[model samples]
Target: MSDTCSNVQGYVDPNWPRPDDDGSSCIIIYGYVPSFALGVLGVVLFTTALVAHSYLLSRYRTWYFSTVIVGTVMEIIGYIFRILASKKNPYSVAYFVGQYFCIVVAPVFYSAAIYTLITPMTKRIGREYAPLSPKVILWTFIICDIIATTIQMTGAGLIGRAYSDGKDPTTPNNILLAGLAFQVFSFAVFIFCLLFFLVRSRNTTDRHFKIFSTAVLVATLAVYLRTCIRLAETAEGLLEFLSTHEAIFGCLEFLPIVIAVYIFVYWHPGRWLGSESIHKKTGKSELEVSQLPR
Candidate 1:
């Protein structure tokens, strides 16, 4: 990480040659290219989801669509910085700033997606089956998610400042650790809530119900894995284990998120909305039929 130290020194003046013995080669920048590429792919997929949702405004929920839009935009911005970093070793301070900011905020929309799922889930599975009220799920997890996001952003800023000031930014690892731990805690609570409701509503059955339930479970599991991987990465700092294992990051972060995105795409609430109209005639709630959340 002395390379980062030297890079910071050279970055202040903006035109200095990169440190020759600092262990960072220009080629190292390209090492991040695949992540940037995957980020772009994420943007496209999320954008498609947004547009499809918006075009079928009557069929899709606004909160879900908006969250997708915002998450996509964040991924786009994150990739832009990644590309910049690819082009410039250590990258410009501004590029690093944007990358950290956007990536950190992206998970907030994920939390929003999680929140949006709760009320609809309660409606679908019957509120009585829900382990916690929609209000409780919303207020508690959303607040914790927000706190995690704030901690991450602040930690990223502190690390940046420390690096720029020629101090050991790794000392602020506790902030990042706290944020990740908070996120994991929130997600664990959510999983408990989901499982509680799901088990309670097991009698409600259908192919679609099964599919959506599996999708929700998969998404939750994916996020949990991503959270753990991030925690490991942060704990590792610039250690060789992290630096040499790019594929591990990809599998832990990208693959899980891809699974999540695809789950959302296929298990969208649109199909069920039509079926709900049928249930209206029977004077029964969709909750009685399917416990799946949107």
Candidate 2:
């Protein structure tokens, strides 16, 4: 099935490492099983979110669900490509382009989840302490994300070209390094701004602060950890023996984001904001706000 497998009309290369040679092997590292499994997971999660959104139409707005759906779709697409690649080991150039680009870029939609939080936080914390308006933050980062994504994808394409050509790995390596560097810088700025807002709003009368703040803090920490691991992996490039060390990367990048997803689902920003708005508009006393809102 693999192009590499087809090309080898001659005897198999004994020099190549066999699965039997190493005690350590996994579907993620040695076969297509991992991609298929992950793809299924993505589909299930995406479908669940869609159903949840449909039922909540009256309770929350479209954009809240839209971002999650889009992010889930990106993840689904990425894993699909991975599954395809698994079926054919020496996958086409487009396979590399599609899979890695989607995998990296999907996180942008994750940031969209972060954006949904702001609308609610704005109401709870008050506009004065919101650090900046939701509109400003949303448009600013989304636009920048577009630009950043373009750079990263373009770089990934070039890297794929390099690999296809069998050129020195340096060309693609540099592009990957550049993209990761920019991503780290972008996330660092976002973290700084978000942390500043939460700190300033800590003492505010917003009832949802306790829940929202904790959720946000957890999400921020997950992003931070994901970025750090990405930085290290990209920096080492092909030189590192652990490039495909499945479990480590999985625990760091995939696991944290999964945790963040559950945290967000638990927090459910739209519900928090809606309840807060109802409380304030009804002119309920601070003590009474708690008793009736939930």
Highest TM-score among the candidates is held by which one?
A: 1
Tell me, by lDDT, which candidate is best: 1
lDDT by residue for model 2 (1-294), tens = 334334322222233332331221111222122355665565566556545644443354535535655665676677677666555431344555576677677676777667556665665567777667878876776676667667667767776665455445566667767766776777677777777777777787555557667778788678667766766876876435334544564577667766666665656655554544454576342334556856
Candidate 2, residue 127: the lDDT equals: 74
For model 1, what is the error of residue 3's alpha carbon versus the real structure, in angstroms, after optimal superposition? 12
Off by over 4 Å in 1: 1-43, 53-59, 88-90, 273-294
What does the lDDT come to for candidate 1?
A: 0.63
User: Could you tell me how far off, in angstroms, the CA of residue 175 lies in candidate 2 after the best superposition?
Assistant: 2.4
Quote the positional error of residue 247 for candidate 1 in Å. Answer: 1.8
Worst 10 residues of 1 by lDDT: 22-31
